[model samples]
Target: MADPRPATPTDLPLIIVAIATCLALVVFTAPLTTLDAMTDALGLSPGAQAWIMSGMPLGAACGLLTAGALGDTLGRRRTFVAGLWLTAASSVAAALSVNGLMLIVMRVVQGLGSAGIMACGLGLLGQVYDGQARRRAAAVWAAALGAGVAVGPLIASGLLAVSGWTATHWAVAAVSAALAVMAMSRLPESDRTGDRVDIGGSVLLIAGLACLMSALIEVRVGSTGLVTALLIGAVVLLGLFWRIERRTGNPILALELFRYPDFSGATLAAFASGAGVLALMSMVPTALVRGMGQSPMSAAVILLAWSGVTVVAALASGRLPERLTPRQRVIGAIAGCGVGQALMLAAGTGTSWAVVLPGLLIAGVSNGILNASLGHEAVQTVPPERAAMGSAANNTARYLGSALGIALISVLIAQKSGAGTDFFDAWHAAVIASTAFSVLGVLAMLVVSRPRGVVR
Candidate 1:
């Protein structure tokens, strides 16, 4: 097939970047609305379903560990195209899975594909676009991510209204296939730096993350002894990974990057947003369906206020004055998240949509602005040579925070909402935890920066 015309130096390749960003998040969250259907169809226990839910993020974490270095060496365009194809194939496999275990395994592969796509897409944005154009593209990219995440469940809910859950998976596969074709034709290859990745570092980081994630996922379902063992193993592996990075020549992550005040602040803010607002949002669909007794579609409709505002805020963030730096914006957004969660809790346990709409709108706008600037700041704070690495570091922290939040939230819900307790009671517990995280995020933002040259 003929390659499409290469984008000129002035062009940002916004279409491809936006589509990839949107679709990756969409596919990741599409399963949220269909959890009930999946468990029922496959006769899955809670443990199996948890794996299916957490599998993608786990794989994505591993992908983040490797994809940035790969993009530096293999060329961003190639990695991006490869990721799209992998995602498409994985989606198809997920759609065809006959058992819960099979589906969970496919989800893991899909997550890895998604990680490559996001890492390369962001890296390419830094490469091909410059000055205000680059900032604008970052804003749009962030907005697209929020829109996709918001719309994914809505799309699945709508599909489930008329068709089975498998239909949603098929739709994702078709979209991914089209995107792969477009990327292959339109995206230009990045200049290959020929930087060989550290194989040992990659393995250690992945192993550490896997153990940590496994411990979190199995907490509620597995035996107490098993959970304790996994937790200890996770800590040991992660500690070793940290020590190895300090000694390795080409560490997957540059331990010294934390020396930059802006980079440190941005990374902390990203983690906070992921663990607090983003994590809490993940629970909304389930809460709507089970706690409020709304149809999946109806629940999605109610959430439009939250998700829609986020897109608008993200798109507009780049245009904001320089006086309000990304740090200020992120801090404000974290505070908003805390207030929003508080509002939700104060509204009481009723099914009334009116109770939470104000908080959702407030939080949504803040999240939009925060998401738009978080990683852009991180990437821009670093030297140009390490732009991809900077972006990857911020994202790795964000996703790790997300995985932790999800696991903790799930465990709390399972423990609180049982035969004797109300579902809303459990939701209340989750919201409180989320609020605490947001508060911590705000405080961290305040202290995260230490003036570039100040000693830690």
Candidate 2:
């Protein structure tokens, strides 16, 4: 498959990359600012906070699958740009949110839009660029996602530093609006032939996951007994989802796509390693607020350091696949993330903020590299026809792990600490649990690894 698309005077992808794709990442991390504030404002308990926080990702996962289907049906450029518009509109609506419920509702809308951009963005890039240019673009895009998460806190803090928290939302809104407009005019839709839209399975898949997350988030908050029954029902729905998807002609998620050993391992590794990485994202911010006694803005900055290092790593990761063999890099990243998880677990328990700083930076760096490597491997192995689905699958795996990681780590850290419990002890327990999980992730990677250090 030699560059099936037209060879342009300059890369069409370079323009698309410059305009729209990167901003989706920037907006994806935008909600971090609101996570703590909304919890306090809405008077949510811990578990409820986790759900509200994870809601965007849940919506995002569904959105990716559905959006990918639409991109395949309508066109990548159009679908991706439409997503940006939806996200921008949601961000503005979120800024006006009166309660956590409103915010969550807004986030659902935001996720729908974000999913569109995320799913189609990569698909279009796949359609636009080829060979080495495509590889470089994919690596950089993955890195950019890491960078956006890293930079978002810092950017939000700066806005809040001068204007205030509410003002920061407006700033995010402004950025989204700018991107939506540019995406509309500047980018080219995918002209790929033989694409089929998978609609029937997408609805069931999204509804099942949404129900499950809703159950989890609610449990964390109100903990109604019937909510318990609802969760059980959601589990049953998931079982049906698998069965129906198998029978459905066009499933949102193709079960066949999981057959490749390298892709399978990489996706699982991506999920687990992400769980380990986000263990810190969820906990550290809590440590800053609950443990170290920092204000929302100040605490965010402390955590932003991790986000900052990730940015640098993501920006630098394009040369990674070329510099080291893919298998070696993937294994190394898994190990590095494990090390970072151990450090995160330890630092959270320790008193000295300075001691925790190094671990935060390490986690950031590991996160950046891990994301790029997995994303690169996932896209490289799939056929051109399956590329959008591949991208959607990767995004779902990573975000779903993040959602679970938040809940699991939150439970671990809080399990030891009560209202009267020692903060350091709770922090230590969470970090240790996170570290243990990360180490397990490395072992999982080892199972799929080849001796020559190639992922295949």
Candidate 3:
């Protein structure tokens, strides 16, 4: 069949998508370094603090699939522009929040906005570029993801030093507003399916994800009964969503896509990337601050060793020999992350931060490769019209995995610390568990990507 992609023009679309994606991530992670200040200023309880941190991911998890479907159906440019505006408004609301609950709600709204940008922005790129150009564009998108993570904390910390936690939100709001204006003016409209939006499926899926993510976030603090009920609700809601999708003429997410090995492998790899390396890295600053007495800004800088390297690695991944398939790159990178995480076993209370530097750097490279490969597979493995849905599914898995990973790691650490184990010792256990998640991901990807006729 003849290719449908347009001839390459100016790189304006790629540049816009990259910046929007990066900005979305920046908003997502801006609270990481400023958590203490936020907690103090908002008078947050532990539970409220947890919500503040988890709200955005929870919102993203709920909204990504729906946003993708909308983008593909309505118009990618329209959806993307709406997302930017939503993010901007939400940021301003968040900046003005007078309490933890308000802030958490605004953060979730921001996540919803980010979901539109993430899924549709990549989808737009997929529509604009094909073949080698597509590959390189995906690499740049992946690098932008890493770059945002690397810079978010630094920006937050710098702003906090000068003004306060709210300043970070104001800064994000301003940037988001500017991007919204730019996107509306410069971005091209993509072809749309003009199908009816799956209202039933969207509602059910969003509710189910909300229940599931909320359960995960509350696992550390909520009563056991509450968590169990939430889980049950999630299961029931999701099961109904599945049935609805099966019967509906226009489903939000086409389940048949899972039959594609590349798509399935990419999804699993994204989950593993989140549950393993991303989850572990999220906790690094905490371990450094509480266990090693490092200042918040110091910890953020230390983390740059991993996140900064990831940007470089992601950009370089597009240059890898074509003989190496995306599946091979994902599996190898995940395994590499496992090995790098294992290297952190030597860390101890008395050790310098430099002890984990090698492991961080190795994991950084692995993460970079994994990100680029997943981004490519996300758009490549799916039908051209459903590019946004593919990106949504990949990212939904990632955020869900991260939530579960963070909850599990927190439980393990709490258990060990409560039992009088040293903080560093508890951290060691988390490292081991996270590495195990990576190994499991590698195994899962292998099975998913196995040769068609080859049986174990």
Candidate 4:
């Protein structure tokens, strides 16, 4: 067969990145509606409710480590197909869920599938593309996924306007199904190999993470006993995982990887980037709707603005990595977003959506740049044989950041977002927090630079 076009997934990097965006689009939009209505429908207390809400991130974290390692070993196509199918199935099940617990269970499954796509996709991409092409592909994928996420709310609002909220899941499920079929036919297989799937370590990791997530999601929800117990259990399980992985010949995470400061710094920077942006993605639009008394569609329109800027930024990211030093680009992106978030906070306080929108635009652009820039840094740090592990580690930082993002924002909103709460005030607080995260991201970049020598 003639070699496929540059953009085709017959090139594994292209295919996996395409699949990642599709998968990300499906559920990310669902949250916009569900978070508002879910507690009422689930009949669960507020704290207990976000458990299912947070479960998506938790599940992804659990599935990513194992999926990345095995994708290299078993075949990326095999895992990609399986993960897409499973994600589609879970979406259908989620649409039919009657209670909070049932939906959480289904969401966990959905997350598991998402993790596979995310972990396997990056690893496969690492193997399929060379230096500059890989960076470009990563940037394009980041841009595409940002677009999908941006489109989700607009699509969800329209679906909810005509049909029930549950119908939206069906719509998302259909998308996943369509992507799965395309994936089976088109996605190129991974070229590298790795150790066997670490079943034991996988279980421990999941259990530990589940416990930790559960503890955090409930800590402020009035469950001191259960939350405390779950946290202790999580700590023990994670400790066990560390000990086991250290002794095992093939561990899920290679400890040696962290010894390289660039890998570690890039991962840390990625994590902070995820936290700041993901949290903003969730809270900012809601603030516009509830605090400012804007229409749902209006709120979504603002989000579209956030998404729009990201696309422009991502396309430009391939150039930044090539044109600027990694440290310069990484630190600049973080600090730039920090300035944006600070403006976002200041504007959100009064009539700043109009003003704050600019900040969000900058923030989105930074995010686009970072996601691609970080991936490039990650793939370069490790040997070709260990690329999947590196990919998994890279994604793990992003997911871990996302988990923290959800938790931090949830706590902030819950604590401050009562009936008496000033809509814009809470919005301001959230933006300030986002700004703080961006500052920390800057710190991460600066700290790393002092030791490594300035990229400039």
Global lDDT of each candidate: 0.79, 0.68, 0.88, 0.71
lDDT of each residue in 70-130, candidate 4, tens digit only: 7767777678777778788998998899888788888888888887777766666766676
Quote each prediction's TM-score. Answer: 0.92, 0.87, 0.95, 0.89
Per-residue lDDT of 324 in model 1: 68
Ranking by lDDT: 3, 1, 4, 2
Candidate 4 is scored at a TM of 0.89
lDDT of 3: 0.88
Per-residue accuracy of model 2 over 49-82 as CA lDDT, tens digit each: 6555676777897678788767766777778878
User: How well does candidate 1 match the true structure in TM-score terms?
Assistant: 0.92
Model 4 has an lDDT value of 0.71
| Candidate 1 per-residue C-alpha lDDT over 48-91 given as tens digits, one digit per residue, 9 for 90 to 100 | 98898888888888787577767766787888888888889998
Model 2 TM-score relative to the real fold: 0.87
Q: Which is the leading candidate under lDDT?
A: 3
Candidate 3 positional error at 41, Å: 1.6
What are the clashing pairs of model 2?
Answer: 47-220, 48-220, 48-221, 150-307, 345-431
**Candidate 4 lDDT score at position 371:** 65
For model 2, give the 10-residue run with minimal summed lDDT: 447-456
Clashing pairs in 4: 352-356
> Could you give candidate 3's per-residue lDDT for residues 1-456 as a string of tens digits?
112456454577888899999988888788888989998898999999889889988988899999999998999889999999999999999999999889999999999999999989989888888778788788889999999999999999899999999999999889888888888878888898888999999999999999999999889989999999999999999999999998887788999888988788888888988999999988888777777778888988999888999999998987787678777888899999998888887677677778889988999999998998889889878998889899999999999989888988888777755322377778888999999989999998898865332111
* Arranged by TM-score, best first: 3, 1, 4, 2
Give stretches of model 4 more than 4 Å off.
Answer: 1-16, 35-48, 191-194, 348-352, 418-427, 449-456
